[model samples]
Target chain A: MIATTTENDSAEHPAVPTAEADRPAQSEARRRRLPFSPWHLLLAPIAVLFAFPFVQMIMVSFMPSRDINRLPPRFIPTTVTLDGYRGLLERSDVLIWLTNTVIVSTVAVGSNVVLCSLAGYGFARLRFRGRNVSFLAILGTIMIPIQLLMIPTYVMFARLHLLNSLAALIVPWLATAFGVFLMRQFFLSVPRELEEAGLLDGASRLRILWHIVLPLARPSLMTLAVFTLVGSWNDLIWPVIAISDSNLFTLQIGLANFQGVRRTEWSLLMAGNVVAVLPLLVGFLVAQKHFLATMSSTGLKG
Target chain B: MARSATVAVPEDASTATGAGRRTQRRSEQLAGMAFVAPAVIVIVGLGIFPAAWATLLALQKWNGFSEPRFVGADNFERMSRDTDLVAAAWHTLLYTGLFMPVSVVGGLLLAAALNRRIRFMGLYRTAIFVPYVASAAVTGLLANFVFNPEVGVVNNVFRVLGLPQQGWLEDPSQAMVVLVIMSLWGQLGFVTVIYLAALQDVDTACLEAAEVDGASASQRFRHITVPQVAPATAFVVIWQTIQCIQLFDLVYTTTRGGPIGATTTLVYYLWEQAFRQLSFGYGSAIAWVLFVVTMVMTLVLVAIQRRRGGEQPA
Candidate 1:
């Protein structure tokens, strides 16, 4: 493929004749460009297009429901009010859902970081038999979508009487295959001699892993923690199916109440949206660097 | 390194410390197993077992409240003629088809634009990524209001622009369009970030060469940049396609398979049948179909990607 493509390209372009014509003038023009090139100016409107929906959501949150649907729509709210947030706080089950989300995300993130890191180390560094096979099995699980397992998962939790409890929400998410994969890649990058030195010094494997590997793997751990946190925080389907009781609702399921079959309380719903999204927005802001780093590094792996 | 050297001394009874060192190696193995056992148990118990059980349940006639009885593929057989399932499947594919191209192209275009240094890059990235962090239910609720036929901002914008004020979600023909648009809104940001990361890694020297050779910006982007980000593009496409296929939350919240069930995705239908109507067996069958469709699509996509990637120069 490579040889044929290269040959075809040479045959088509015949570089010698036109090469000199292209070079000098374009080279001179490139050197005089502004630091803020016109191409850079193209970014802002594109950014605006990307940012439009979010700004619209916030704008709509401030408007009265009556104005939300008006033709010749208003972008800026003339009658900006705290009505959505107030209605969300007083009438909706938004508070309970928020609490449930916090609890579920905390547990899921904490467990994932600890378990996945240890398992990742064991898979990456330890020379245990069947390790490759075990890792492959875990990798295989990534291909199966959660939709396929919901029914049986629902039944299992129901039989265990874990339905409608935070346990069901946190359990399935506690250890992700992606986390293990990410952590393993991270562990593989750390020098083997660090753990070996600790082991040679008569440190138990747990102590060696804890004292040596964990500290070295902090960045990846942070990445995994953020992934787990975001994943648990935004999860909807499992909570929807597993917990019918409103008391058990995550912010997502709770907000689903504003959506009645006939008429939706648009103002309250948007307000509820603000409440639900605020924490995540703040969380993303605080961890934006780590989040971006994690995403880019994840791309490198898979 | 010193400690490893000691451990690697191949059963040498040097200084008569062999017994203790052997005991230590055994304990290390035990500890390793102990560390990994919990995660293994969790995956087996929670992940694999349930998935396997779901496959079995699909073959049986089971509603959660009853003693699930074996029905021997009756559920699978019935799924063949289930009109709602068929409609939902068609809608899901339509939704995937509509959503993937828009988000991918939007992502690629935005990423290309933003790859150059721009003022307030962080702020723009943050604003774009807000939808990704928000729960889909919330995004859906917002969309429902924004796309509402009578009062939606979309209609207002159209009217203001002297354009036709078409029904966004109420009209059956255009209902899927609203969902597709909303899906794009939710997905575009994530795909942009992914592409942005890929674009950052493209060789600047190669791009400079293209520029020096009198390639226009579009030509440079097409010939030099796109091929470099092909893998990330493939990843974004496959991931978005899978998510689109199982799209239930937004449709559930906004449309509820509305305006004549035009937006009922297969997962939504499965949720309705299994959880809503308690036809667990039938829903399970539908769920399997989704699994098959997703897996097959992903495989085909990955293969095309591999071939494309292999053709690219290092």
Candidate 2:
């Protein structure tokens, strides 16, 4: 098939004198002087459809509870109020949930970065017995569904007397198989000569890895940190099962509870949802390029 | 230098450097273990061990509290006979069927549509991708409100159009459809971003050549673009299918498998069995089923990916 393709390409190249015109044609296709492509008209409504919910989420967050439940629903808020937030701050345990979420996410991200980098660096540069096998073991777990892990994990956590505490949440997210694989992939790409230079200078492997390999690993490290942070913060299932205490809830769990308690209280629920969503959005916008690259590359590997 | 010299074994220096090299080699081994310990421990303790333990419990008759009795597949036997299990399995399969294709197809189209440079490209991409980054539970919560029969936007739009207003989540008959659409809304962005990345990476030379050969845009896209992005399409399909199989968070927040168990799914049922009903053995059995299903699908995907990746470079 490849031979045929090459043959066809070779044959076709002579037929189009405009082969030299490829670059010009490509540039012409991308010429931004014309922004009014038929695409914009086709996709604008779809874009709006995708974004309108978020807009409505923001708008309804400020709408009074009464306004939300009104027979003829209002897309826009009749009156904006902080009562939704106020209700959370005053009535619910939003503060505890926020702090728990922060603590869990922070520790999870920190530990993932530190431990995954260590594991990655080890797998990449170290020549130790069973390193390949160990690496494969970690990689192998990436496909095991969380549902399968959930039941036994909960039982184990319960056995350890770790349930209802933040420990359960923090431990699992501390070093993910995927994160380790990601970091290992990144570490493998860093020039070995850089580390070898340090090795030749009588430096230890760990020292070289720290001083040489790690500096070049800034992008992967940040991506891993961001991914870990987003995952730990927004994760719902494990936390939902692990911690029954309302006071120990993460942001997502708190929002679920906020909705559960007042099923009709759309305003407060939306506000809670915004709060649950905003940090990751901030993180994503900040690391958009790295996020896009990492999400797709890692996604395909599975 | 010292280690290399030791390996080369200079006659006199060998004795001194041999000790040093052994120490260095030992240290390297220790360093590897030390470096890898935390991650390996976490993976094993939380990941591998749980799956193994779940498998063990799947065959036992443990309620998580009492002495685990050796049931020897009694739970699996009971699970097969369970009515809720059958219905939930069907519901999950139905959900996966409805959800995966729509997500993959819609995602590809959106990706193709947004593939070109246009005005506010970043804005559109960001808007489409927002729902994906947002928490599932949060979106599911928002969906509940959006699909609320009386006061929700969906039914209001239906009423405005003089269509029969469906009691979306509240109605058992319509709940799964509502849930599926909601799931699609949340997940569409993820698949789109994946495809958009894949689409951008699709070989442009072949596409241009096809176009230059007087191929229509649709034909060129169908013949050239589709094959180039086949790996990505396979990826999206597999990933989305796996996601659908383990569907839990959306169901948890939206309907909680309510209105006469219309929307009860596998994981939802597993949670009910293991956590709510305290039927840990039964839940473990279900977990094993989920584990096997997902692992098989993932392995198949990986195999396909490997073959395609090998063939493509040739």
**Top-TM-score structure, candidate number:** 2
Tens digits of per-residue lDDT for model 2 on A1-302? 23343344333221111111112355467654655666687788888988887888889889887887777888888888998888767877877988999999998988888789888888887778989888888877886778778888888888889999988888898888888888888987887777765665567666676778888888788778878887888899999999988879988888777677888777778888888887777766665666655566557356
Using lDDT as the measure, the top candidate is 2
In angstroms, the error of model 2 at A268 is: 1.4
iRMSD in angstroms, per model: 8.5, 7.5
TM-scores of all models? 0.87, 0.90
Across B151-260, the per-residue lDDT of candidate 2 in tens digits comes to 88999999889999888889998889887887787778777767766665566677677777778778877877777888788888887888888888888888889888
True contacts kept of each: 0.49, 0.65
Expressed as tens digits, the lDDT of each residue in A89-130 for candidate 1 is: 777677888899999999888888877987787787666566
